[model samples]
Target: MPWQKTFTLGNKRKGCHLITNEVVNAIQDGLQNVPIGILHLFIQHTSASLTVNENCDPDVRSDMDMALDTIVPESLEWTHVDEGPDDSVSHTKASLIGSSISIPISNGRLNLGTWQGMPPPTVATGGARSRNIQASI
Candidate 1:
């Protein structure tokens, strides 16, 4: 049988937000005892992105986020400033970070490392926002 699930995340930034184990747990909960299959996870937005990162340390996330900001600073000379200073940067970051990830499922479980976890969704200003992640099994 095939199943699909949607996860809603409250992100604090407008950039790359690493999901947490809870999101993975939700996917696993839906795929429990489903045998071998492919799990596809997609984020439905252009200004946001998804990624898998080291969840063992919160500092890692902070460092990575900071690095992205440095690489794609909001003050860069961008033409698509109709929205705001962060509008173009948001799109650029999303393009670089990507919008989806697919993983293989085995024995009804996700193949992930001990120190790895879903990167929580983030925004630029560290404000509250919603993210939709679709998981198919």
Candidate 2:
């Protein structure tokens, strides 16, 4: 049987944030009964995206932000600036990074690598924001 759950994650700042714990805790109850399966997480926003990467170092996150900013400079010519300079760049970065992930579930726990984790790389937009995350088990 397949189980599906949806939940909203509170605002995350304008960078990458580790959300492995949040995802796990939210689906812990549902996972307890399933010994093996695939967990698919989807983010319902276009300005932000999700990716699995190093979790032990904070520098990696900051570095990634810097690199992305350099790659997708806000100064570029974009006609979609009705929102702001960050709007177009945000969409580009989100497209490059993607917005969903799939992980294996074993023994009621997410099977992630020791140094691997998922981070929601939020870009462009500012202020408090929430991500509608859907999990399917």
Candidate 3:
């Protein structure tokens, strides 16, 4: 049988930060007695996104966020400035990263590597924002 669950996370991005564990745990909790299957995670948003990355070191995530900001700096060069400078950059970041992730479920748990974890949701503003994540098991 396939099961599905939706979750939201509160994120306030100063620049770009990772939201670790919450989503993964939700998926795990949802799949808690499923035996074995595939887990599909989807985030319904463009300005923000989801990813699976190293969760062991906070510095790794910080460095990655910094690098992304440097690579796609918010400037006035984009034509999609109807919203703001961060608008295009937000879309660019979403395109570069992605809005969904899929993982394998085994023994009623997500079969992720020892060093792997659910990356934090990337928020574009300093204010509180919510991400809708759908987990299908």
Best by lDDT: 2
Candidate 3 error regions (>4 Å): 14-20
TM-score for predicted model 1 compared with the true structure: 0.83
> Candidate 2, residues 1-137: lDDT per residue as tens digits?
88889987877867888888888888887788778889999988888888999999999999988888899888898778666668888888999999899999998888999999888876437455788888999
TM-score of structure candidate 2: 0.93
| Candidate 2 error regions (>4 Å) | none
lDDT of 3 at 32: 80
lDDT of 3: 0.73
Best by TM-score: 2
TM-score comparison, 2 vs 3, better candidate: 2
User: Model 1 — which ten-residue stretch has the worst lDDT?
Assistant: 120-129
- Sort by TM-score, best first: what order? 2, 3, 1
lDDT values for all models? 0.73, 0.84, 0.73
lDDT (10s digit) by residue, model 1, range 69-93: 8988877788887756777777777
Residue-by-residue lDDT tens digits, candidate 3, 21-54: 6766666667788777888888777777777888
